[model samples]
Target chain A: MAQLFWDDVEIGMEIPPYKKAVTLMELNRYAGANEEYVLIHMDRDYSQKVARLPDVIVMGNLKYAYLSNMMINWIGEEGTLKRLSAQYRGMDIPGPALSTEPTMICKGKVTNKYIQDGDHCIECEVWTETNEGQVTTPGSAIAILPARS
Target chain B: MAQESLITDEVRAAIGVETVSPPELVEMKAIKDYARAINWPDPPNPLHVDEEYAKKTRFGGIIAPWCFYTTLGRSAPRQRVPLPPARVGMNGGNDYEYFLPIRPGDMITTTSKIVDIVEREGRAGKLIITTSERTFTNQNGEVVGIAHGTGLSQY
Candidate 1:
């Protein structure tokens, strides 16, 4: 397979989206890794009574990390993940809900030119939406792909 | 100090102070677990699982997936600006940039500085918005990543 070169990519291209269904155990592990001992994420009772949340919630950064793979997978081997910024708009609850799966879409030309002869920076608007199709985490990124001449 | 009050003069005064966490070696176990926790298993994400397979990728060895830097750190204490005393601080947003891959055995250290902090009125009443910038470097002193985060605080 040919590496994703600058010549191959075009504006308005869409990197196929990916989805992940979050779970409670995943939330707990994420908390432990970041040393984020916040009760709203780990303790259900505290989340419900004190924090006034529905249930244990997933960490925002965890969502960022989980969703990052979509961009990583899209850029392929020779490309670099230049930048990604996430604006966490909605609160995500862990557990079985029809609304659990979050999807990331890498869409259309944020920049007109993919840098030539060296690294071509493919920029795009990246986003994650809830099952209801409401945008949750809206972000952008600049992915650099090498010119395979 | 009252909940409705503006940010303390101290918080404003302490801006630009830099703090460095102790060095920590990136671990493959932690990387694997992070991938699994995200429900990213098998097929495509083999670099986090099969060591031999990772040896073949451009990364050259087992590596934590992208955005793993968020969870990279140790319990080492660092003295930095203190937040205005508030009962709750929520995750506001994150702006991250990657320079290089974090591989197993790479000693990762972060130097962070308080860039901005301000108080504003919101529907909830008063909000203290604090922003910080973290620069991550590997043992070779090569910059691996940078992350800027904004957090909101309320009483």
Candidate 2:
């Protein structure tokens, strides 16, 4: 895979999308990684009986973590991810896969913050869509990429 | 109608005040498993594992995904005043800025401050949005990242 440089980006360009299949094991594993002891994410009965969720839904942070991974992977090594933000709009049930696609939002001359400092910063509208074709997490990011020059 | 504001004086007073804790060590096992859980992939690009590979990279060593800030060194995210026992609370969202990555064997500390508490009437009726800003700093006093997240309390 070739590294993505600032010169290679164009506004409105869509990077290749990536997919992640969710599972209870992944969720449980994340619980240990994140040190989150929320029973809602761990206890199936509690999630169904109390929270009334479809099943033991994925952790909100874990969902965003997946999104961050997508953003970092798309930009490549020289690019620095400045910020990542996501809003959890709906519950995401495991057993389904989520696809992430990020579209370039910065155009020629790159008139954003980094450019003033002589850095080429790329911005993207990043989002995750569930298997059912619903956008579960919608967010945006700013990445500073190395210039070709 | 002005609509009764859930932003009580107590909540307003909490804004900008910080609740900090001592530094917590970052363990390798925690970072490694987290990478696996997220399916970040391994080997060939072993920045998360192989020290030799990491040393050749710009980061100069293994770096955990910045998301590790969720638990690393961060403590007591619950509102200082504490929400009523009856009101159910859930994570609202996460907005993170990564200046640096959490490296293995780093002793990090987090400083959390309540920035805002917005009260609104939503589909679930009464809602209290507790927003906090956290700064992650490594042992050498370099900032790792800033995480501004929210927790929603439904009354």
Candidate 3:
């Protein structure tokens, strides 16, 4: 893990994109581990008839984790994940892949840079949109970057 | 209001109560194993063994993935299983506010408080979103991080 000097990053810098395709196997594993017996996350018939979902969908936390994972990996070791905020906007259903029809989109652009009480920080406008151009989760993050040597 | 019924006097008494505990030292190996378990691509754990890279990390030398909370294990209080299972269940989302750096060799304990519970009508049925605010503290009692998450249960 290489340290990213504050000077190396600039405003408008775009964090690389990331994609996630939820699967039944992954969904079942999460449900089993968390002991969440919500039919919509595992039972396809229940989700379709009861929840009106296209199919059983991925859990919201896992989606958020995917977004968080993207940002953390972009920040590297010298950077610290300070804050992450997200709103659940839509669902990611199983079948034909959630983001595959077009693409599973995870993109972020640096929006602000500053020092808060001695902590070097950068704020970003981040989001994940579905294949059809629907914004699934709108989010933002703050990271502490190491000072340039 | 539907929320009023859910927040009975008995439940109201449980609000705003803070539970504290020591931090659990998250291991790098555990983080890597979790990613492997999920089979997620581009494992987030930066493969590094040099002390220099580890020393710069607030998490001591161990580089933990961002979603370490999922990796941090805690048993959920038992709940009665309602007959005819709920039709929907979802994780609303999470808001993480970082305070202190989580260092390696540090034992982390989480303090979780039930913040709010609201009932709403979804396409499926009566849905409940229970929000909980959890704070993580190191062994020295230093506040490390705070997270807010919601669990959606539909009946």
TM-score of chain B of each: 0.86, 0.84, 0.72
DockQ of 1: 0.62
Ranking by DockQ: 1, 2, 3
Stretches off by above 4 angstroms in model 3 are A1-4, A8-12, A25-39, A49-52, A95-103, B1-5, B19-29, B37-39, B47-60, B71-73, B76-87, B100-106, B121-126
The CAPRI class of candidate 3 is acceptable
In every candidate, how many clashes are there?
A: 1, 0, 12
Q: Model 2, which residues run further than 4 Å from truth? A: A96-114, B1-6, B40-45, B76-79
Candidate 1 lDDT over A19-135, as tens digits, reads 776666567766766667888778889888876677776778877875577677777777788788887777777655444544333232344445545667888777776666767
Model 3, position A84: C-alpha lDDT score: 90
Candidate 1 residues B24-82, lDDT tens each?
A: 87887777776666553224477777899888988888878777877754443554455
Per-residue CA lDDT of candidate 2, range B1-155, in tens?
36666676875888888766688888887777777766632222366767787888898988887677787544545446544542556788899898987888998888888888887787757788878898888899998899988888777
Q: Name the better of 1 and 2 by DockQ.
A: 1
On residues A73-127, what C-alpha lDDT tens digit does candidate 3 reach at each position?
Answer: 7887558788997777788765453333323567788998888888788999888
Model 1, stretches more than 4 Å misplaced? A1-3, A97-112, B1-4, B40-44, B74-84
Clashing pairs in 2: none
What's the lDDT for residue A103 in model 2?
A: 15
**What value does the lDDT take at residue B146 in candidate 3?**
83
lDDT digits (tens) for residues A19-133 of candidate 2: 7666666677788777788877887798888765677777888878777777667777767888888777777777632323321111112223336478788877776777666
Worst 10 residues of 1 chain A by lDDT: A101-110
